[model samples]
Target: MFPTIGDLISYIFHVNAKVNLQTFGSCMALAFAGAYVVFVAEFKRKENDGTISIVKVKTASKTMEVIVNACIGFLIGYKVVAILLALWQGQDPVALLFSLRGNWIAGGGLAFVWGIWAYSTHKAMASQFIHPYQLMPYIVFMVAVWGFIGAKLFDAVEHFQELLYNPVTVLFSRSGFTYYGGLIFGALTYLYIGYRHKIKLIHMADIGSPGMMLAYGIGRIGCQLSGDGDWGIVNRHIKPGWIPQWAWAYTYPHNAINAGVFKQGYYELPAGVYPTPLYEAVLCILLFLGMWMVRKRLRVPGAMFFLYLVLNGVERYYIEILRVTPKYTLFQLSQAQMIALLFMAGGVAGFVWLTGRSYFSSTKQIP
Candidate 1:
């Protein structure tokens, strides 16, 4: 496994080309990009089928647009200018960009330029109409932000003692994510935003299901590729006749976390662990395909979403058994396991109730 894109490139081309691109981060980004495409497709289909209608909204003032762009520019300029300077000096990026040091002058200049450009683009427009799919980019951005925040918050809770010892380090570190936390928070954020857009809860839920599942599946590929410690318990079992050993168990060489003792430049686990992330990626992608295939057939408003929940819940619950997660004494279940059960229960209840109603009746009524 390659920890970073730099490492991957080094291996592939036999060069010491140093790039700052992180494997997990890159894949996480890819996950969102792929999901965005899926979402666009799903939304277009719904629009074509007349399941949803176009939305009309007032545009913001040119001044407001400039302010927003300027703010974004300032942040980007701050980091990017510093990064470029570091590259010029051949300094350690981890030490440079990760620190508070930045060129404020560059940031201010960039912000000014960005604001002017935005002002130029923003002519007087009272309102505009758009398909709900146009909002998916912003929706994806919100999910990434809130999902990351939620994951960090949950991780903090899980390691309260450690957090107390080093609050800044634990809070700011790029690793230590809890997918369930992200899922819950992201779902809430999506629903809330969709509601604000006047999209029906049922339709919102239905539209988000396939894309969300696909994103998770793709994101898990990052976990597998980077070996970010989402693996299962040690596997020392004898090899099966038909199964490949690498598939059954992996030592996770060149792992990102540097968990095991380092004999050489790179890290490697002493023993093999079940590649749970790979398993999840495989299962979820398959599930996503199956769900996507039958989504049209499930005419019930929330039926597709409920099916996603049930299948995802069940998969996580079983995978938790094989995983090495922190468990609560209550029923000896992990936090994720408890959440999984809740999801399963809620999914079943919601699925049955929604499916009982006639989709035709719901379709005729606007949200």
Candidate 2:
């Protein structure tokens, strides 16, 4: 598994590169891109159905534009200047970027110039209002940001002992995000945004269903690629002759997190474990396709969304059986499994209520 693009590029070039283009990050970027495309399609469909109004962009005041541009410029300039300086100094670029080691003078100067350029360009361009659907990218971005924060927070809670011992490392580490945490926080954010924009909550949820599934599938690919401790327990079962070895079991060597116990002679783990992440990726992708196909035919606005919850819950719950997570022995389930049960129940109840309501309403009009 290639943890970073740098590793791949180094293999191809036969030269070591310091750059770390993390596989998980790359997959996440792709996930967001994919989600945005689906969001745009769904948004258009809603607009065509007269469920939402077209969004208009009004010209911003000169001061407002300058302030916004300046803020953007400052952030860009800070990171870019820091990275370039690190390269010049032969320092670890990633470390420098994450640390408070930027050249403030250079960053400020670049920011001033960039802000001026942006402001002038805006003034010269014709201002026009765009469709609200066009803001899907921004909405997706915000969801990602908040979702990550929530995921991290939940992870910290799960491993409270570890957090207490090394708070900084636990909080700042790139790994250890909980999927359910991300979903809950991300949903709340989406709800607020939809309400603020006057978009129907149920309709927005339906629109996001496919995208969310696709994103989860794509993200799981990263877990497989990086082997960041998301694998299953040791699988000692012999593989059938017809079955591929990788599918049945895997010994993830040189994983990004450097997980697993070393064997007698090898630097990598000797025992093979179930590749749960790969299984999840394949399953979720199939589920996503199924949902996409039936989205339009679902008819009821909230039906698709509820169905998604049910599918997601079932998939995760079953997958948890093969996963090697800490279990709540009293309940004979994992924390994720408990959450999955809740999601499934909620989905079932909501689907029944909505479908029944629709049925009765149609019958009333049948007079």
Candidate 3:
């Protein structure tokens, strides 16, 4: 029912603060960062003092730490800026930041951050006891499960009856959560655990690469199945009769069948809409294939991950054209559109420099 990004925020949370599923997910990311910091500090100390001296922070560990810290710093910086923006409008930034004072749900948000950070750091210190890469899969799996539950719970809060009829469905329900919620949180969880255990991210990324794409593809399937409102439009004007009626047509269970109908009538997606997420999954698999083939082609750190960003950005940008999400326009382009452009720019820059370095080196005469 809510058409625009602005409306979705207001309608869902009744807040003009510009928060949504993404923001909640970011909160989880921060928790991951906090956890990593704790893990790194503790694990490193234990390794140095331990009798067996079995612990070693490998290159992968360092890279993971560095990248995660940078991400966390960015999040904190953004939050500070948001605070300043609020203050300029005479809003109490501090109050807003810690508004979890009375709300259990908001408290959970805060607690999610604290809990993950604490638990992860504690585990990281003893990570030497386990194989780094061996643990990453489980962590990511946990992230997938928790992230889904978190997003679904948030959605159910917005749609109270959906929870009332089948409370258990809140945990199993598909299609109601946001993708970014899972990505941001899931990535953070993996990063924290990987860095803590000093997993070789470069190689590990290659190893786990397919799973990333596969997981996303599977998640999108959930979205399509539940029709939790991630449908694309059926551009009646552009496609005319070319578009099938079923392409954008969807029927929700009538009131008698489900808890309650949040939005009346079947959702009529915008015409000519592409199933971008599904398309993205396919692209990810292809990109993963490319990365896997050349896992050993480059010696540089973070090469595969950098490539992933580029691929992801490209996929997202192309899909934005067909997406109907709300946006803040800049030069007539949506926020996601601009971010994708930035990702492409960064990826291209990195790729060029890396390849150039490699190309010159390969041609150099060796004694």
Candidate 4:
């Protein structure tokens, strides 16, 4: 697996471009792209079903459009120009990108020129209904912000000792994110945004179910590729002939985390561990496809999402069996396992309640 774009490029082109295009970031970009596309299609589908109405503005100002576009352009150029300059100077692209260094003058100058051009060319158009898809970028931005904060917060809590010893490093380091934490906080934030936009919470949840699953699957690909300490317990057992060795177990050499905990005579780990992340990626992708296929047929507003929760919870719970994680003494279960149980129970309760309500409503309507 390619941990970074630099590694992939080096192997493909035989050139040493020591740039770090993190696999996690790449997968996240892909996940967002996929989610956006799926969201647009789902939004259109809902419109066709007459479930939601499009709102049209009487008039829109080209000035506002120009200003927003210009701000976006400026932000992109501000960071990108600096990175490009560093690359040209033969500096490590990743290091330079992450550092507090940039060609601000050039970036600002270009942004100013671009903004002027955009303003001059901009024109006000006839009023039209605003598509639900139009709000996707804002929704995505909110989710990302909340998700990142939640991930970091939960991770910090999990590794409280590390945070106590090295507060700055633990907080600022580019690792130790928890997926469930991100999901809970991000979902709450997304729901609030949807509610503010006068959207039905259940419908919004249904719309996001499949895309979220797909994103999770893609994110796991990043975890697997980077070997970010998400692997399962060490598998000393011999692999069966039918299964691929890499699939059964893996010695993550040159892992992105550079975790060289084991030492027999060498610096690197001597044994292979279960590739749990790979398993999760595969399982989540399959779940995503299944949910996507049956989404339209699930008439109940919240059924799809609840089903997704159940499936996701089950997958995580089972995977925890093979994973190497600290466990609570009460039930010999890991923190994730306990969370998974809660997710499963909540999903079941939600599904039953919704289904029962739907049944009662249908029965009452009968002649």
Highest TM-score: give the candidate number. Answer: 1
Compute each candidate's TM-score over C-alphas: 0.91, 0.87, 0.49, 0.86
lDDT against the true structure, per candidate, is 0.86, 0.81, 0.50, 0.80
Q: lDDT of candidate 1 vs native?
A: 0.86
TM-score of predicted structure 1:
0.91
Off by over 4 Å in 2: 9-19, 56-64, 80-98, 103-106, 121-129, 262-267
TM-score ranking, best first: 1, 2, 4, 3
lDDT of candidate 1 over 174-290, digit per residue (tens): 678889888889989999987887889889889989988998999999898888999999987887989777678898998989987687788888988899999999999999999
Q: Give the clashing pairs for model 2.
A: 55-132, 57-129
Model 4 worst lDDT run, 10 consecutive residues: 261-270
Model 4 clash pairs are: none
lDDT of 3 by residue, 1-367 (tens): 2222333467568878442222222333444443344333323433354311332443335446545544444445446556556656655454455433233443345445644554455433423344333343357457766666556665565455667887776645433564544565566666665566555444444344444544555444434433334444444444347745334443323211232334456343332344454455456656656665675564475575567668777877777776655555357665556767886887788789878988889889564
The prediction achieving the highest lDDT against the true structure is: 1
Per-model root-mean-square deviation over C-alphas: 3.5, 3.3, 15.2, 3.4
lDDT of 4 by residue, 233-284 (tens): 9898989999998899888766766776545532344578899999999999
Give the TM-score (vs. native) of candidate 3.
0.49
Q: Which residue pairs does candidate 1 place in steric collision?
A: none
